[model samples]
Target: MLEHLDRMEAHLRELLEKEGGWLPFERFMHEALYAPGLGYYTAGSRKLATPTDSAGSSDFITAPELSPWFGATLSTPVADVLRDTNSLDVLEVGAGTGALAASLLPALAELGLPVNYYILEVSADLRERQQQTLAAWEPQVRWLDRLPERFRGCVLGNELLDAMPVRLFCWSQELEVLERGVVWHDHGWTWHDVPADSALSRIVRERMPPLPGYLSEVNLQAEGWMHGLGDWLEAGAALLIDYGFPQHEYYHPQRHRGTLMCHFRHQASDDPLKLVGLQDITAHIDFTAMADAAHASGLEVLGYTSQAAFLLDAGLLEHLQSLRESDAHAYVLQLNSVQKLIQESEMGELFKVLAVGREAAVPRGFRRDRLHSL
Candidate 1:
């Protein structure tokens, strides 16, 4: 890890020296995640995930680590999706540390839902580690490089859409989309406006309603991913859980710069260029655009709700009671996890949960009665 970091530092030094004193934020981000040797995710370094939590850990924490309650809540929806069917196959994208999978498998197992869990993880190191953590559930577990042609149960993703590469755009006063580009200028890396030539423009114009803003981020990759998921599902449903806002709030003129941030050792910062390949960069997902893509792909947007609402409807309290009555210490730990997930100031409000399904007999438990379709 240290060696790769050193090599990356040297490469960055050379690039900066030749071009300017700094690199564009995107370039820095690319190096951080995909750099050959020492970049955060791609590098041989152990920066992102490890056996134990230690100092200088990769930035950012997802709900899975917060508690088993989230997994319990997730199961309700999965079970609901698979209610009429006995055989269930779940494909989970980006199983960070495999926490959700670890918790969810047992929860569903208790519910008598025999599940074949398929984890599609991109990181080699994380995949190997996940194999060990999930070793006990051997017969039912299968690792995949991608989603299969047809699946019955559910395709679930948590905190995934935000990480997809996005195209930055600024809407001019004329309401035209202008592409944001990076250039080596003024002895440093700088941002400049360029003509929008990407195919994303057509989709954005057609699906994304006009917003009166010049500076914003566009996640074309996310839309593509949605289309792919819908196509691959072929039979079942897709559940996307991520931190984001509805269209109105996300594209409001007041936002100005859009949602983009970096996490380093649990500290959040604005400058993604500060520490290349050593931190996590993420943007808040735009749920509206995602739904639009799903609809276009022939998938019905079944429900969209806040994480809190989704969990409560899914019987979070029922699961909590069952655990609490079983053991006092375990109940306390579970409560702490629930608090992190449902509290107003935490992931509860910020994270939006959307479920898209095809030919489902009924709306899942998470979307049972009070679901608001967006």
Candidate 2:
């Protein structure tokens, strides 16, 4: 850990010297999270869950924590994809702690479908942890560094795109896409604001979704990744569960600051510049942009909705009933988990679920009636 910190410090110092004693926030973020052997994900002592945590350990929780039935619910729609494409394989990206995999794989096992599960994770430490947690099902699980050449199974990613480095831009009625650069002054690093550039400024002028618009975040990386993901699957579905807003909400004119955050030991912090590579850095996803990229890449956009709606359509309530009727105490625990996931004040509203594919017509897992599009 010490060595990693030293390496990161050197990198930061170098960045400070270049570009007139500063760096773009996106550059800082990339180096902080993904720099070889020195970034937060690459250097940490694994944050994944262990058997000791009762299948519920993490800095933050996800939908799968609600119940094993969450997997069973997801399978209902996934099974349809399999039937349509005549394939039962699955590709899961960024399977943190492998909790969802542990829950979903066993359920997929019993479905009697000829299945191959692939996990693509960038963190070596977390990959090792996933291997240990999922050792019992070696026959079904495979590790990958990147997406395969050709695939027909469902592609899954939860809270994955939000972590991709986003280029931050500040906008005004006159000036647009102002760069959020950092500069080293007398004592320490501070923000160095600059005028709008050619490419991003054009984006702000032509492509920006109707937003209130004082400042906003841009995830060009997310768009690029979605395009690649869509291109990889010959015929299948891509399921993404993440925290983000549609373009309209993302660029609300009154909104002066974008959603960029850092998490250290479950505590949320607004300062990404402080910790360097010690804390996790993330930004909110833009669902509209993701869908646009998928469409541009020849993938059909099926459905976009909130996590709550998707889970419910997939039968979260049914799972609750079955589990509750059998064991009241366990049912109560599961309900609590659902509360954190779907409550309007919680992740429910904050997290949006997007589904894209080639074979599936319109995914049945979302409450499509409620969606407002770009």
Candidate 3:
């Protein structure tokens, strides 16, 4: 582990020197998380697990890891898209541990709709782990290194947009915009502010409030990803689940400090400079920006809602009742997990679901959606 860290640090130092001792935060973040063999996601590390799993073995746990019902309930909306489009294909981006695919495929089959599942994963290490976990469905599943030129299926991405690189910016007392980047100083990485370029400054001035000393991030990469969706997503829906808020709430006056976070061994921190490539670094998504990008790309914003509302509207209670009749013990266990998933104080409210597609029906999970809020 120490040797790997040394190599990763050296690689980062080389990147800094190449950029004249300063690197844009987005560039640094991209390399820190996706650099060919030295980045966090590119390295061979156990990244996902349930909280009950052996401590310190994984960096963090996602909603699918907390309960199989997450994927089971999600199958309803996915099936809707498949039936509406008359397609038998499902594409999942960043399929961690293949847990969602494993749980979702069986549920979809139970609903009398078996589809081809494709995973577009960039991490070679994660692809190997997903293959091992999904071996049982070998014939039905395939992996791809990049997005296809054209596709007709339901696209799913859980916690995907948040991991994309974001440019950090701050406002000065005079309301001047500045780009916050990284610099090598004192034999370590540190923060350095520079006059925001014309493009970045224009974006900040238009989207962000004129509050002095406010710090936040803008995810142009994620927006670009959304814009590209229309080119390949010929006739289907893309369901993105992540933690974020609308533009108004995202750049609200009170949210002075940005939504940047890091995780290691299930512990959360605000520091991304520490641990180099050994920890996970992420920021919150801007759903409104995503919706705007979808519109610009000629795709419709089908729906938007909290995870809790989406789950309930999609028949979570019915599934729970069925489980209760079959096994009382398992029912009790899952009830606890459901509370964590839907409660206002937990993942339920923080996490949101956004659906964008071309010629796709509004998913059943968005019956009570809050699209107007966006």
- Global lDDT of each candidate: 0.74, 0.76, 0.91
Worst 10 residues of 3 by lDDT: 43-52
**Candidate 3 residue lDDT tens string, 202-312:** 998889768898999999999999999988999989999999999999998888998999999989999888888888999999899999999899999999999999999
Which residue pairs in model 1 clash with each other? 32-277, 170-214, 171-214
Error of 3 at 368 (Å): 1.6
What is the alpha-carbon lDDT of model 2 when measured against the actual structure?
Answer: 0.76
Q: Each model's TM-score?
A: 0.86, 0.90, 0.98
Least lDDT summed over 10 consecutive residues: which range in candidate 2?
48-57
Order by lDDT, highest first: 3, 2, 1
For every candidate structure, what is the RMSD over all alpha carbons to the true structure, in angstroms?
3.7, 2.9, 1.0
Instruction: Give the clashing residue pairs of candidate 2, or none.
Output: 212-252, 212-253, 213-252, 213-253
Query: What lDDT score is found at residue 315 in candidate 3?
Result: 89
Off by over 4 Å in 2: 1-6, 15-20, 46-58, 65-67, 172-176, 207-213
Model 1 misplaced stretches (Cα beyond 4 Å): 1-6, 9-31, 44-56, 172-176, 185-188, 198-213, 365-373
Tell me how far the alpha carbon of residue 138 in candidate 3 is from the true structure, in angstroms, after superposition.
0.7
State which candidate has the highest lDDT.
3
